[model samples]
Structure formats: C-alpha cells, structure tokens
Target: MSTIRDIVILCNNRMAFPAIQTLHSLGRLHSIGVPVENEDVKAFCAVFASDTGINLIIIEKSKLKFQLQEITAIKDLKFIFTMTFPWKIPEELIRQHPNLFYNFHYGLLPEMRGADPVFQSIKKQKNETGISVHAIEKEIDKGKIILRKTLPLHTDFTHGMLCTHLSYLASYILPEVLTLLHRNDEGMHQDETVAEYYKKPTIADVSIQWEHQDSKSIQALVNACNPWNKGAYTHWNGLNVRIVEVSQTDTLSADQHAPGTILEINENKGLIIQCYNNTQLRINTVYTDEGFMSGHKLLAFGIKNGEQFATL
Candidate 1:
C-alpha cells in the first residue's frame, strides 16, 4: 500500500478511466492530459478534473512535443503514464526522460505487442491475453516490461468487451507497477527473440477472406470487429455488407459448393453459408446500407438462398 505522488496521465478515451481512478485514489495523479481533438474524452476529463480537483491539460495533437516538453519541466513531475494516447512522443523527448515515461498497453508484449492487440488477439482466436506496463522507449511498445496482468479471453468476448476488461486490469496492476517504480526497479528487458509488433488494424485486416477462412476463423473475425469496426467486411452481390454476429452450424457444406456459397436459409436456423472447410456459419445479424438488421432480413434486400457472398 505504498502511496506515490507527482504523476501525469496522457490518454484519449474511456480505456484510461480505470487507471486514472486508481492513480487518483493513491493521490499520485497530479494531472491528466487529453488531446483537444478527442471531443468526448476532452469533455469528460474536463469535468473529472473539476470534480476531483486534479489539473487538466488540453493538448493539441500537432503541438504534442512542445506541450510535453513544457509539462515535463515541472520540478515536481516524477512520472508520466500514457494510456491509449494517440501521438507518438518525439524520439528525442523519450531519450531525454526515458525513466519518466511509461505506458499501459492493453496487450501481452513480446507476442501481442501492437497498437490494436485487443482486436488482433480476438481475430487470431487467442484464448488468453493481458495488459503490459512498460517503460516508454524510442520504439513504440518495445519498452522493457514493468508488470503484466493477464486474463482469460472468453469465447463470447468482442473487441469492445476485451478492451473494457483490460482497462480494469490496468487499474488492478497499477499499484504494483508504482511500487516497483518507487523502489527504482529497472524492470526486465523484453525478449527480442520472441518479440513481435502489430500495427493498428486497417480495413483490409477486418475484411473477411472467404477463400481461406473456415467457420471458426470467420466467427472470430466477426467478434473481433463488432461494436468497433461495425463488423467483418465483405461483399454480397456487388454490395458492401458487414457480418455482425454469427455462430457455427452443425451442417457441413457439399464438396461442389465453393466457400462463401449460400447453403441454406432456414427461419429457425438462420442464414447458413459455406466456409473454407466443409463447415458452415450461421449468420445471426448483419449490417448493410439500409441499416443493422436480422440476418433473415437480407432476403428482403434480394439476397436469396443461392446468392453468394465472396471476398471483394
């Protein structure tokens, strides 16, 4: 229960809420910095700062380097923590205050190291993931590890769900991290041999690869994209569509039918489609230009039982 002080947090969204609370409770949160471009986070932090009597610094994304240099000049500034902060710190700034900065990355480092590991882990069908607190170094997410708190990746977890879970995990792990830092612990260096880096996911990453992905893989992709990217992107009869929710079906596809073929459309069983293997996926919900609707409603949009949805 070692209480620390003179800390600042840089963040852009709700993922930082838990950590902010933990630091404030310990009386270690001296200030919070939010990019002015992030309207919701900016407004929320403004009110939070007022209520908690913590200082709030509004930052311009373009002027991040200058602003950070100024903020770090405070004689009492002991540590700076960034949680989901958007801009990369200037390499020179990191080099100058290497010990003063740390980041709470919402992913397991050395394996799931990346900007969007929450999405990547779910998309890759990993059964476990964790949060990593590491010193901020020149290379992004390549810092030495201070602490890691892992959790089971539940089968029903979507990208949003896992993000929420990991945010709380960050709060739970923060005290231990602060205690280590208070003791001047240098922390362990990451294993370069097993290290990997995942850049932020893009449209192509969320797009479904019908030709290569089986039913399980497709379902994982769907979960990985839901409530975040809307869903897994695909094309149906020349129209863009997103598969929002799906489940594996017991029925196997016939050898003659290619992957992405519409095998059946049962009212009770939902819309079933062929996948890479003989397995099938039962679509529960979908999103189209019309709106988000039930999978069965695709019939009204002229998607018949034989209509196929293939990769673009």
Candidate 2:
C-alpha cells in the first residue's frame, strides 16, 4: 500500500477545487497557496482553511521568494502540485527540493504545451484532447511526463465544457499520480520533435475569419470562444456581433454568394450564411449591444439576405 502525505496545492481557479477536496479527504493536504490577486480562489481557500484547519498561503508575486521559503519550512512537506498557477515556479525552488513539484496541464503535453491550450485545442478542431501530469521544470510545460488521461473531443464541445471535463479528470487521476511519484517514478522526457507551443490568444485570435474558413471551421472557432468570449466575433452592417451558437448546414450556396454573405433568413432555421467552398452555416444565436438574441432577430435591425459580414 502506498501512503501519500503532506501535499500542497497552488492554483488560480475553480478547476483545482476537486483536487483540493480529494487531497483533504485523504488527509494528505498540508496547505493551499493562492495568488493575492485572484480573489475567488483566495476566498475559497480562506473558507476551506477555516473549516479544515489547514494553512492558507497568499502568494504575492513580488514577495514569492520569501513566502515560498517559509512554506518549505513547514514540517513533513512532501509534494507540491500546481494547476494553472499563472506564474512559473522559481528555478531555485525546484533545484532545492528535487522532484518535489508537479503540474496538471489541461491539454496533452508535447503536442499542446502552452497557455490556454484548452481554447487552442478546440479552435484547432482536434479530435481528442487530454490532461498531462508532469514534473515542473524551469521552462513552461516542458517537464517530463508522469501520465496523461485523454477524452474524445466532440465537435459540439465548447471551451467551457472541455475545461470542466479536464478539471474533473485531474481530480480522478491524482491518487494514481501520487502513487507513481511515491514509488520514485521520474516519468519520461517529452519528445521535442512533435512539441508545439502557442501563446495566449489576443482578441484578434478569436475573431471569425469568414473569408478563408469553411463552415465547420467557423463552427469550431465559435465553440472555442463560447462563454469566455461570448462567441467568435464579426462585424455586419456597421454593427459588431458575436455568433454565440452556430451549426454547419449541408446546403450549398451559389458561386455569386461569397463567404459571409447572408443567403436566407428562416424563422425556424435562423440566418443562413455562405462560407468558404460554397458551403453554408446556420447561425442560431448572436450577441450584440442589446445582449444575446436569435440570429433571425437581425431582420428587425435592417439586416438583409444580400448583406455580407465585414472582412475585418
């Protein structure tokens, strides 16, 4: 039987809540670390600490060095786990406590090793995505892998939906991961050949590229940006709009109808728009200054079937 003890978790969001709960139940949690700026996590940690009598460490970025040093002094400290910690752990800390740190990445390692991999995975239309448990190295997400748990990436899955699934996945696999670490498993090095790194997306990255992208591609982009960004945005008739819900249609458009051109507006079908390769998409929901509205409601705003969405 493997015994796990005295683990600390550093996290920035609700995604780590399940993991924290699991550790607390197992009596292996030592304390929780939260960024001073993240109010929600700090508050959650405060309440949890009050109820469970566990320590809550506030991580001020400027004073992280001293705070981290203090944490290490706590008796019987064993392992440290981080999930979307917002900042990199100092190299000196990892060197001092060799193999003491592990991070849960929301996407598969090597293939998706960068910020916001959840959003990027969906935007890229990946057929599958996963969570990776790896040793924390000096570089971002460059650590050797301990294990990975994957789930099918459904076409209808939104960024928020995938995030929730990955969070639960992390909790579900924590015990096995801890057992592996306890047995002196150093894990395998990541293959650099297939590795990729993507930076955090800017507003421009979430915008719909109607001209060159096909209907299915556009739908994927929309799903990737849901809730977080409302949806993939575009401008039409001088009004900015976000397509909240969309689905690719089997219908084909005439050559004269360029991509982004509105082909028809059906009460039941919503707005039908031309897409690249003469394909079409049914726009179900949209967000504007008036808030979220059905795509067909654009008719009241003087939008017509022939008008095209602005390319920019």
Candidate 3:
C-alpha cells in the first residue's frame, strides 16, 4: 500500500456553524491565506492554496467540504465540509500529489444527501444525525466511504446548536477515520436506494410565506432560517421585518384579514400579524434601513389594531 501524505484542514467557519466545533478538535494544520482566518473555517479550498501532499482534511463548515473529486497535489485523507465534492478535475492540476483526500458529511451518505446537511438534518428533526468521511469521487458523497459515526439531534437544537454538536463530533471522529486510512481500512459503501437529495436553500427560499400555509409550515420556515438568515419576510406593514423569535399558537383561526396584515400592536407585545391560515405571527424584532425599531414605537406610527397593515 502507498504511504500517507500530509494532512490539510479546510474550514469556512467565519459563520462558525456546527462543523467548526468539530474541526477545532482535529489535529492542527498549517494556515496560509484567508482559509481558516480569511475564508470560512469549513471550506476544503485550503488544501490546494499552497502545498499539496495532503492525505487528509478536516472539513470545518459542518456542512461538507471539498467540492471537487480530485486534487492535484493534495489528497484529502478525509472529507468534511458543508457541500459535496465533485468527481472530476482537469488533469493539468494533477502532477503526482493530489489536491484533496477525503470529506466529512453531516448526514447519512447517499441519504439526506446535499449541501446544508446539518441545517436540513436539524430542521427535519431526525431522530439521529451523523457525520461521514468519504473519498472524493465525481458524484458528491458517493465515493468510497472511509468513516462515519452517529450524533444525536436534540429538540432544543437550533441551527447554531446543531453546528456546535457537529463540530464537536468532527473533533472526535476525524482522528478515528484517519486511523482507518492509516491502517488501510475502508468502511461500507452507502445504499444508493435510500439516497435523497436536498438543495442548498437560499435566504429568499426560507422566508415566511404569509399566505395559506399551516401553522406547522410557518414554524418550519422560521426554523430553516434561524441563526443564519433569520426570517425572510416583509413587515406587517410595507417595511421589511426580519422575524427573529416565533412561537406557535395552539389554535388556527380565520382572521379574513390578509396574511401579513398586522392584527394587534402594543408596547409590551410588539406587533402580532395575521400569518398563514389565520395563524398569528408575533414579531418582537424588526430591522429598518436605519436600525431597530421597538415594538411599541412601530405601533405608534399608525400601527393600530383594526387598520390594515400597509394602510396604517
């Protein structure tokens, strides 16, 4: 068998999502340009920045790392990042050393298979979440498996919280996967039949759809954007209001009032607006081009109880 090369650490945690926690635990790696410092701590882009001979890389983004299958001088002994690694690369970059080695994924390989694995996993409220270390082939997360382990997702875990959990897991799990590679040990191939795909959601995609959705759908929208994009929505009035905090009411009603219409306003309660299907959305926080506006003051500026949102 061939001997191991060097180890690379790729991270894009400027956002410091869950994957960052795990990358922190792995053995140290050399840093150059903006990768760990300048770039997201969870990016595998660091591998080819300077040197190659990288046999391993600890994906830092808590998503997936390394979007490419092959690395010229670097070989990721492992994969870890927020996105998947593509299969092929131009031959010009390849000399003898490879560019990437391996990748780590937040969800089951082939299943829950896409970027924002951690985010998608948590929002779906899966009973369990895990990480995967796989070799970079053409199709992402479709390469030969190197290592994988389970990590539970708690109910209270938000995007931030899930990121923390996965980061910690990367710490403990990476070294173990490396040991396997060192010993020439390869793990199981994924069951392609079970594989499912998810797209990387945009800030606009997760925004509140104040039309005929159910209360549960509203909650999902809120959860999807938490800790990152927050809420994607406009104000109960014409202004844009980023929904920060949300709690569902027990019952659903028919307010006839247009969804996104402000239903109630008070100093203490903030602005309660009619959301999907008569569901009420209590918005405690808002953002204007200027800054933040207190709930009470918003009401004072023509945000009365019965007045339609924009009219007020």
Candidate 4:
C-alpha cells in the first residue's frame, strides 16, 4: 500500500494561490498560512475563511522564527512545501526533516538561483526562464531539483506579467511534483559549476546606464523593472525621471553625440535618445516629478533636443 503524506504549505504571495487551491481541492493539504500581513496574504485568508476544513495560521513577521520552531513539533508532518514564504526555514528543522522539505522557486535551478530571478532573467534578455521544484537545504536555492517547467521569455513582459504567468505555471506543475514525492523519488542534484546567484535589485541596480549600455539592453532593463520598481530611471535637471516604456530605433544618426543626449523629439515617433554603440532608444512613456506623461510632453517641460539626461 502507498503511504499518504501529510503536507504543510507555507506561502504569502498571490503567485501561490492557484497551487494552494489545487492542493486544497485534493484534500491532501494539511495547513496553510503566511508569515506576515500583506494584501496578498489578506486576500488568501479572506477567501479561505469560509472553508472550516482547512487550518490557516498567520504568523507575525517578527515571531516567524519562534512559530516555525513550534511547527517542527507537529506530529506526522510528512512534508513541508514552501511557496514564496518570506522567511528562511531554520537549518535545524531542515536537518531534522531531511528530504521532507521542498520549495517552489520561480527560476530554473542552478542557473538563476537567488531572489528576483524573473527580473534578472529579463534584464539579461534571456531566451527562456522556468520554475523549479527543489529540496530546501542549508544554502539558499542550492538544492536538488525535483521538477522544472520552462517558458519562453518575451521581451515585452513586465515584472507583474512575468510573475502572473509563473504563478499559473506553478499551479500546473505542483500535482506532478507531489506525485513524485509520494513515490519517494530523490531529485537530481544541481551542478555548482554552472550556478549563478543574484541579489535583490536595488534602485542603483535598475537605474539606466545610458553611457555604458546599448539601446537594446536599456530597453530590457526598463521592461524588467516595470510595474514593480516603476521602471529604469535617470536624472533630468536634478529630478528623477523614470522611463516606463521604450523601443529600440533602427534609425541611426550620422553625427556623434554624448550618450543620453536627446537626439530627436517627434510627436508621432516619440523622443529619441542617443545610447552606446550609436544606437537610440525611443521613449514611449515616462514618469517625472510632474506626473506620468508621454515622451512628446517632455518638450513642453523645457526638455529639448541636445539636453543630456544624467545617470547616477
């Protein structure tokens, strides 16, 4: 006879909602909750409140460590599946649980290990990105890969769009991963030689490097940071200016101008700025101190041709 595993799901993000619902419908989900209060967490709690069959535990962010310690004492907890759980699981608990702990990471294992993989993948202009189901270990994301599902990386995908797509993908693959675990299938180990890690991007990291990067790279950076970091940024007359939507222009200028210099201002074609490699970026949408406006409106705000946007 096959053993039925009692699974505890710890998640706080909306991306895990679909997967949570899938597990709940199967009647195999043991417990669910978040480590903190947020819009996503509140939404999940409110939706599941009517279902008295499932137990939801909302641990205070400050008391998460203590609460996780208490969870370790739950008898017959065969597996713990963490989906976008904010806090790191205690190493002691992982050691005690052995192969029972697993996590759903947004990025492919080994290659895009660490925080904000979608953003990194978009910034790097990757051809593909995927989700990974892996064992949780002492190191962050350096775990054994159980299952993976790849998706095409679209150039126009904003931060929010990529996250939404990944969430659905997570929901789709989770049942298969559970089946694999039930069969006691040990996952494949990750290759450390090809591994890459990225820290959460700061404002500086996402800021547009007009002089150093080409137009294509700049456009990718802007798209990668959208609907989350509010797009890649620059400085205009000491004021912060965010480029929300941009496109690379095939039109090349014969005359050389400093990078970040406004090359052309056309109502139909938008504002064009010189970038590295003699390329140009056509700004479609922008956010400045005044408010969100199109590139053509910048001319009315004293931004003219030959004006250079400063980078910090």
Candidate 5:
C-alpha cells in the first residue's frame, strides 16, 4: 500500500487561497500557514478563522527554521509546497528535505522567472504564459519542472486578471501534481539555455515613454500595470496622471505632431494621444490628482488637445 504524505503549505498571496482550500477539503494538507509580518497573510488567514478542521499558523520568517524543526520532530513531513511565499528558504533546510520542497511559480519555467511574471508577460506582449510547478532550489526559478500548465493571454488581460486566471489554473492542476509526487516521480529537468529572468517592474519600467514606444507597446504597458501596480504613469500639467486603461485606435492623423501630443479630444472617442510609428492610442480611463475618471473627463481638469504629457 502507498503511504500517505504529510504536506505543509506556505502561502502569502490570495492567489493560492483556492489551492489551499482544495487541499484542505481533500484532507491531503497537514497545515497551511503564512509569515505573520505581512498584512496580506493575515488577511488570508482571517478568511478561514471559523474553520475548525484547518489550522492556520502565523510564524515569523526568522523563526520559520525553528518552527519547522519542531514540527518535524512531532510529524513526518514529507513535502513543503510554497505558493507566493515572500522569504527564501535556506539551502540547509532544502538539503535536509531533499526532493520534498516544491514551489508553484506563476510563470513558465526557464523564462519569465521573477517577482512579477504576469506583469512582465503582459508588458512583453506574450500571447501565452503558464504556471510552473517545480522543485525548489537556491536559485530562483532555476529548479526542474515537475508540471507546467499553459494559459492563453488575451490583449485585454490586466495584471490582476492574468494572476487570478493563473491562480485558478494552479489550483486545478495541484492535485495531479501531488499524485505524481506520491508516485515517486522526479519530473523533468529544465533547459538552462533558454532560461530568462525578469525583475519586478519599478515605477520607471511602467512609466509611459510616449516618444520611444508605439501605440501597441504603450497599451501593453498600461494593461500590464492595471489593478495591481495601478497603471503606467506620466505627468500632465504638473499633476500625476496615471493611464489606467488605453486602446489602440484605428484613427490616423496626417498632421505631424510630437509624441505625447493630444491630437484629439471628444466625449465619444476619448483622449487621442499621438504615439511613435504614426500610431495613436485612445485613453479609455485615467487617474488624476482629483480621482479616477474617464478619458473624456480630462477636459474638466484643464487638459487641452494641444498639450503634451511630460515624460518622467
């Protein structure tokens, strides 16, 4: 008879909540916990406060080693699944656990490996991205792949949208991955040749570069930053203007205008901004000093058709 594995899950973000609940419902999870220092972790724990069957422990990142040592003394923990866990596990602990440590990275392994893969994927205009379940190693996302599930990326998917979709996909495939691990499958090795890593997007990375980027690229940046990082930003008339949502327009202007110039403004058509490569982008939504407003409302804030957005 096959032995049942005792598994502990460490998660911080809401994306992993569905998967945690699934494992708990199946009676496959030993415990689910998060680092106590993070507010997001606390918020997630609050959602399950009434559940008597599931135990949620909040341990400090610094104390996790000792906590794990104590838990290992009482129970035979065969695996640790990390989902959006903030801190990096020590190499010594991983060495002790051997093949028992695994991480669910919300990106295709060997590429788009980093803090915010969904955002990076969107900004890069990738048509498809995926979730990678892999062995945890000292190097971030350099681990061998145990399982990977691809997700199609639509042009309109924002950071939050893509992440939510990937989270659902992760939960759906987790059971099969656990089954494979229980069967003593080591999974497949990742190719190092094609591996690429992306850093988390900073304010500068998301800042709209109207002079350098075409309409499609700018729209991608806006989509990548939405509902999480907020949106790609630019200064307009000394006020911080966040381009929350934009769309590539089919309209073309024969008039030569500098990039970032407001070519047209109409309530029905939105704010049309000239971009590189003779393309124009219609601003659908924006956030200004006043508050979030539609593109047509920019006129009320003193935004004129002849003015240009300043580059940061």
Candidate 6:
C-alpha cells in the first residue's frame, strides 16, 4: 500500500476552497480564514498539533507567521506551502525543508511574475495570459519555475472575471503540480532573459491616461480593470465618475463630442464621449466608492448632452 501522508492546511477563501477539496480527500483536514487570529483556525490548529504523523503543513505563504505563535511546539512540523497570504516566514522554515516550500503564481514565468501579473498583462494588451507554478524565494516570487501554461481569455473578460478563471487554474493545476513535484528528481530552471517582473496595480494604473495612450490601448486599459480596482478613471464634467464597463464601437465617428459630452446616448448604445482620431468612447457604466451607477443615470444626475467632462 502507498504511504498516506498527514496534512494540515492554512489558507484564505479563494485558495482554501480548492486546496481543501483536493487534499482533504487525500489526508487530514483543517481549514482557516484570513484573519488567522480567528477562533476556528486557532482551535483547529490546537487540535492538529496533537498528532505526530501529521507532518505536512500546507499554508498560504503570507500566513506562515500564524505558525509561530506556538512555535516551539510545531518546530519540527513539515510543510508544502504557497505564498499568497499577507504574513512572513523565517529563513529557518525554508532552510528546514528546502524542497518542501513551493509558491504558485498565476503567470507563465520567465515572463509574467509577481502581483497582479494577469491584470498587468491584460492592461498592457497582451495577446495572451498564462499561469506559472514556481517556488518562492526570499526575494518574493523570484524562484525556479515548476509548471507554466497559458489559458485562453475572451476579449470581454473583466479583471474580476479573469481573476475567477486564474483562481480556477491555480486550484486545478495545484494538486497535479504537487503530485509531479513529489515524483521529480530535480526541478526545472527558468531563463532569466525572458523573466519579467511586476508590482501590484496602483491608483494611477486604474485611471486612463488619455493623451499618452492610443484608443486600443485605452480600451484595453478600460477592459482590464472594469468592475474592480476603481475602473478606468478620468473626468466626467469634473464629477470623477469611473468607467465601469466599455466596448469598442464600430460607430465611433470622426465626430468629436466634448470629453464628457453625450456624443451618443441610447439605452443600448450607452454614452459616447469624443476623443482623438474622431473616435468616440461608450461608457456603459460608472461606479463611485459608495455604489455603481449606469450611464442612463448619469443623464438623470444632470449630465447634459454636448457638455464636456473634464478629467480631475
């Protein structure tokens, strides 16, 4: 009979769901929410600590510190973890079981690596986006590549939608990757030349830079961050309405409406604003920090036709 390993999991929701389903079937079960200081995660850990065969500790990378509270007790505990959480791990942890520590990123490494990589790629208007399963280093996501694969994305996909897909990809690829990793004699090395890095998207990144970017780029920018991350921000009659939804228009004529002018307004057509190259932009929706408003409501809010919306 094959050796059945004992496992304890530490992760937040999005990841915890899938990782839980996969591993819980294979070994012992323990689940936790992010605010790791919570009652359930702590109580579960307290019970889990009683077992010696339960050597494996699978946790999201950031929450590794949750393990430290009762440090000396679980000192010899083994782990196979990922780094998507908000906590930190000591060098001693990684050094203890060098190969056991694994990090998963949603990108094709030697290319897209780091936070919001998929969002960054889509915003940059790449033809495709991919996911990478790599080991994590102290320098963050800079580690050896394990498995990399690109997934198809529809042009209409919003950042929220894309994240959902990537979350699925991470969940699906993880168990298989773990299986392969366990059997591997040596891990694969990544090429530094093709390696790309990124940071979390900034407020400036969410806003549209009208002058510097072309229409397609601008549209992609709008598409990439829609429904989340503050949308494609600009100015709407100085009201600071965010673009929540968009679609490139075949009807955008050489006619320039005022920046925030109602160049075109129809329930189906949305509100079109004029731009360079006679291009018109149709903003389907707008969102405030408090709530989201549709283009139709913009008119109700006293946004008149032919009036320009200035960028703030």
What C-alpha lDDT, on a 0 to 100 scale, does residue 168 get in candidate 1? Answer: 91
lDDT score for residue 230 of model 6? 57
Q: Write the per-residue lDDT of candidate 4 for residues 1-312, one digit (tens) a residue.
A: 223336678887788887877776666676786765676776666568456466677778777767876766666777788888877888987887788789999988799988889899899999999899999998999888999899999988887888999999998887798788878888999999999999989878889988899998998899898878777889888778889999878868888999999988868768999998888989999987788889878888788888999897
Candidate 1 lDDT tens digits, 1-312: 434458999998799999998899988898899998899998888899999999899999778899999989876788999999988888899889868999888888878887888898898888899988899888888888898888999767988888899889998888789889989888789998888888788888999998999999999999999888889999987789899999877986445678888887767767889888677888899998889988887888777777789786
- Structure candidate 5, residue pairs in collision: none
Superposed Cα RMSD, model 4: 2.2
Question: Model 1, stretches more than 4 Å misplaced?
Answer: 1-5, 253-255
Q: Mark the regions of model 6 whose C-alpha exceeds 4 Å error after superposition.
A: 1-16, 28-78, 254-262, 266-268
lDDT of 5: 0.84
**Candidate 1 C-alpha error for residue 288, in Å:** 1.2
Of 1 and 4, the candidate ranking higher by TM-score: 1
In terms of lDDT, model 2 sits at 0.89
lDDT of 3 at 293: 62
Better of 3 and 4 by TM-score: 4
Q: Which model, 2 or 4, shows the larger lDDT?
A: 2
lDDT of each: 0.87, 0.89, 0.54, 0.84, 0.84, 0.61
Residue pairs clashing, model 2: none
List ranges where model 5 is wrong by over 4 Å: 1-5
Best by lDDT: 2
Tell how far residue 2 is off in model 6, in angstroms: 5.5
Residue 41 lDDT (model 1): 90
Q: Put down candidate 5 lDDT per residue, 162-275, tens digits, no spaces.
A: 888988898899778988887878878889888888887787998999889999999899999898766889988778888999987898877898899998887977899999
**Model 6 agreement with the true structure over 1-312: per-residue lDDT tens digits:** 122443334443353345545555555333322344444544553454444233334444455555643332343333455525545446676665566556666656767766767677788777777677766566666677777778876777777777778777776775667676667624578888887788777778787765555556667787788655657887754577777787667665555454444676657667776655555666777776547877766776667667775554
Error of 3 at 107 (Å): 3.3
Q: Stretches of candidate 3 above 4 Å error?
A: 1-5, 14-100, 122-127, 154-156, 235-237, 251-258, 292-297, 306-312
